[model samples]
Target: MRRATTVKFKYRPHPKQLQAHRAQVDELLYGGAAGGGKSMFARAEAILLCLRVPGVRVLILRKTFKQMESSVLPKLLEEIPEELAKFHASRYEFTFKNGSVIQLGYLDKDGDLENYQGPEYQLVIFEEASQFPENHYSYLESRLRASGEVAERMEALGLFPRRILTANPTGIGLMWLKRRFVDPYPPEKVWRPKPSEEDPEPGTRVYIPARATDNPSLNKDYLKTLNRLPEDLRRALRDGDWSVLDGVRFSSWRENKHVLKPELFPISLLSGRKVIAVDYGHEAPFAAVWLCKLGNGLIIQYREAYAKGLTPVQQAELIRDLSKDEEEASGEPIEVVADPAMWSRQDAGAHKTKDGSPPVGSQAHAYQTVLNRRPIKANNSRIPGWALLDEKLRIREDGEPRFLVYNTCRDTIRTLPTLPRSKTNPEDLDTSAEDHLADAIRYGVMHLEGKFSNLDGLDDYVDTMDPMETYRIAQAEF
Candidate 1:
């Protein structure tokens, strides 16, 4: 028989951590700048609960198992003395001598929620909680349940089932987290809470802010790294400023300058080439945006249509109808530019059209057959496309932005301001966001080829040189 040995672990809490550790709230958040020991607090809190309350189940998680191993596993191991707590490697769980369990899990995707349905955890710790969606947080908290003696012991211990969320001030969940917990409440202030429509969990919740300075022992190099981040990121990780709003890319978007109400729009001013931009999706979302670029480089995004599960033929017909009014109002011929993927040939199963003939496998072919117009393949460069979108969002000294969206394009207007920046490449939009409208806008704007930009000065170079030389210089300037 193996002998049982107990190893003790000790942890000293910083002031912010202590506030969170002592919180009697149903949901507690200890978040702010990086190097604030945000993650360390979650680890210590999990261990303490398991040790004090026998048979208590503590679940500590990050967004992915890879994140758990890389960020939490090493520190967690040092805190575990491995005494009588037998760790099951496959389960990624620790079964303490007193029947308590601490399980390390990852909620990588929404589908992973099913794995946790049966476990009634008493304490749930979200490490870097900002990386998760609000729905994930709510779903997990709903699973915080216990019955019988385990519940009695928990009651006696004065430990009601609770959730501890630790994060820096950034990620996809930034806005929701800020709205739910961070912004309304001041640091260290607890609320005697009531249920709200957005967050109906009944219990007190509090925000205890953490800063890099809070952890005197946090590495100088890590602090230096945080300081070196971009202005918004630096403010978030170093100063812990929630007002900076990190996830959104289009901070320059102003409603007055960019939105054109149907009654206010001057449809008669649209005298240049009109374009219908498309992004094709069958199971996901398909989007088409109608745009009219004026000769003065002004671009008006006048209309849009977005939906999912539509065949290419259906999409083409929808686009035709959506653009009919605008084309007639402006008395301008409209050209079509579609996503490059729309031209790809499909297999035998691709024919989704009613006719027994070939499936409308290629969206461009379908457009040609039905609308009698083949769409020009759009420029698909993501980075440059996003830059072009940024150019449109920029407001001039006249307080008029080059890009204007009609109030009719509700999806485009709604999705643009709420799109989160990609964590992997901060410069890009998070692809997981509902970005079909943005994609359609990108396809259209990129196809305009920067002709409507502030590059009209290039025409002057032509007058100073020979015809051939001037054309060469103009192309170079362009």
Candidate 2:
């Protein structure tokens, strides 16, 4: 048997992974929350085993190169002595003088693992496994079968090991992981803690839970940063709790300043192309927002939220009056952007005429047409509209964000946080919540992406179309 290294390094492991690692258990899993030393635990185990085996080949897989370069490589170099840390710059692998080789690899695409199809390793570590889809992990796992005496050594060591994974939970499908790992399972003698539920053909796998508090040497600056966050964000980042509010979008987007109010756009002073975003409602409020492009930027200059108790004609009049006022003040006609379903289409229940127009067309069209003979475009495409808004709201240099809210737009400021999900079963921001004003802003900005006559051609280089369409068009070219 190969002799274990007598060298000792100054390092500490998390209590949870430490207990499991010290045991004769085979496989182990350490997960949950940010700031936890989950990644460090995997590294410690890999190094210790490599030293004992002398030339024990280990494989460490990361989802991205950036993560490996900044995190895994730095810590591994810091832990092992300089003499043993022989660098392989060309292959991105590290070899220790003791004959242990720790190979660094990535799996951004599942096919990327074909190069290691025939390889075998005593240790395999996966960092941020959740970032990759489930299929990628399954493919890489097949390559974990180690042969020869090392396999017997693993059995004698009582290590139930096969593969390991670590990651912070995000988006949907995470609930499935929580149920499988976070929630307790029935105990079994073979897989006592029930970490090997997915091992159908038998063999050992285990999951160990961990959090940021597990690391003893965490910096005070990181703690201070956690403390300063809003209540919900603080919980997600520090507590590692998976809980969240259902209606909020852009939960991670934040500001260091106090809440500002919306401002009104005077028809006389307003310049450039004007537009409005509308969120139509049957039982809810018929909300609309007036938006204007200033120089190279966009702002939600005015917002109004009203219930649908009024007829479509009433809504049209309201929109017409608002448009006339803005046009007279700004010397530019206000082009109102509405739901695509509301225009150039038959009413939901109305009969269509020979010309294809509805016998009883949308009351929405009636109201909007009163303002201008030509209909302003309606954006029903979620992907495109979202990109348009994102481009407009993006902040420029000097620390200023691209989008701004007027002080007078109270309803928009109040309800933006409450928008519903775009999809019925999705976990993302609905994009339809108290979103009438936001929708208006999106349409206006997208309309301007095509062409702008008023500029000194400064923003002329800007494409006046939805960037999502651009991506989709590019994707089709492939």
Best by lDDT: 1
Lowest summed lDDT over 10 consecutive residues: which window, candidate 1? 469-478
- The parts of candidate 1 lying over 4 Å away from their true place are 1-7, 196-201, 245-247, 250-478
Q: In lDDT terms, how accurate is model 1?
A: 0.78
- Which regions of candidate 2 are displaced past 4 Å? 1-6, 23-27, 171-176, 184-199, 202-205, 244-478
Per-residue lDDT tens digits for candidate 1, residues 1-478, read 9887656677888887887788888888887777788888888888888888888899998999999988787777777777747778899998888899999999989899998999899989898888999899999977897788889998887778989998877777776777778655567889855678965766788988888888988888888888788886787789887645566867667555688886776666666777888888989989898888887777898878889999988998888786678767765548888887876676645534454332355667887677776567776656556766777778878878889999777677666876787776655788987788898898898778653334344335333445444333333432
Candidate 1 has which clashing residue pairs, if any? 351-359
Superposed by TM-score, candidate 1 places the C-alpha of residue 189 at a distance from the truth, in angstroms, of 1.2
Provide the TM-score for each candidate, comma-separated: 0.55, 0.48
Q: lDDT of each prediction vs. the true structure?
A: 0.78, 0.58
What are the RMSDs of all candidates, in order? 10.5, 15.5
